[model samples]
Target: MDLAQRIQKMITPTIKDQGYEIVRVQITGAKHPRLQIMAERADGTCIDVEDCATISRSISAVLDVEDPIEGEFTLEVSSPGIDRPLTRLQDYQTWAGFDVKIELKTGIDGRKRYLGRLLGLDEEQRILIECEEDEPHTLAFEDVQRAKLMLTDELIAAAATEQTK
Candidate 1:
């Protein structure tokens, strides 16, 4: 597995045990490497600064022991913002009815990009999206290259409400 994937696999259990779930793991920069870990409560609650610091310390300890990186690197922990990538399968279900942009690994009907309201996962695990005025689009989960929520006034309002709760 890649570094990010390996780190995710190694530290996910510990993070979950701490009452949080890993949203995404990314390593950026070459000379000054940075490990960006986006995390949130499993219950879909907003994570506060204290929670970020807590997770950072816990993850730092694990990374220190593992020594996954050859050189020094900076670690950052934060909550996934309102416009977050739809990484997990549950994300699609939870954020259904929201506008989203999805890119497929292999083109579907000579197109790889799609923008529409999320329709969530179908019974067969395909991602359903209501695109255009016609029938909703069904895509294989494995075919998704990238997917993220579009920032809109409704999304902003929903995020504010979620943060307050």
Candidate 2:
């Protein structure tokens, strides 16, 4: 498994016990590697600074013991904000009807990126996106390199509604 995957496996139990679920784990940079852990409250509430601090401390303790990284690395814990990434398959269903930007690992129809309304996943588990084309484009889940919600008034309003819940 990759470094980020390994780290996620190591930290998931602790994070879940703390009532949070990881959105994504990414390790970037060479000289000064930065480990970014995006998480959200399992209760469907917004996570705050205190939650990030708590997660950071807990993850720090776990990493110190495991020593997963060869050298010193910066660990960052934060919530996936309003325009969050669609990392898991459930995210697509949850955020259906929102505008999104999806990039594929390889070009499809002479394009690598697509911007349109998210139609969620089809029966075959492929991502469905309605672009400028007449019909919705069906994209394989494995082809997606990265996908995230587009920042729009509708999304902002939805986020506000979620926060108040």
Best by lDDT: 2
C-alpha root-mean-square deviation, each candidate: 1.3, 1.1
- What are the runs in model 1 whose C-alpha is more than 4 Å off? none
Candidate 2 residue pairs in backbone clash: none
Write one digit per residue (lDDT tens) for candidate 2, span 27-122. Answer: 999999999999999965668999999999999999999999989999999889999999988888888999999999999879899999999989
Q: Write the per-residue lDDT of candidate 1 for residues 32-106, one digit (tens) a residue.
A: 999999999989887899999999999989999999988999999988888998888889999998999999999
Q: Largest TM-score belongs to which candidate?
A: 2
Instruction: Report the lDDT of model 1 for residue 79.
Output: 85
Candidate models: Cα lDDT each: 0.92, 0.93
TM-score of every model?
0.94, 0.95
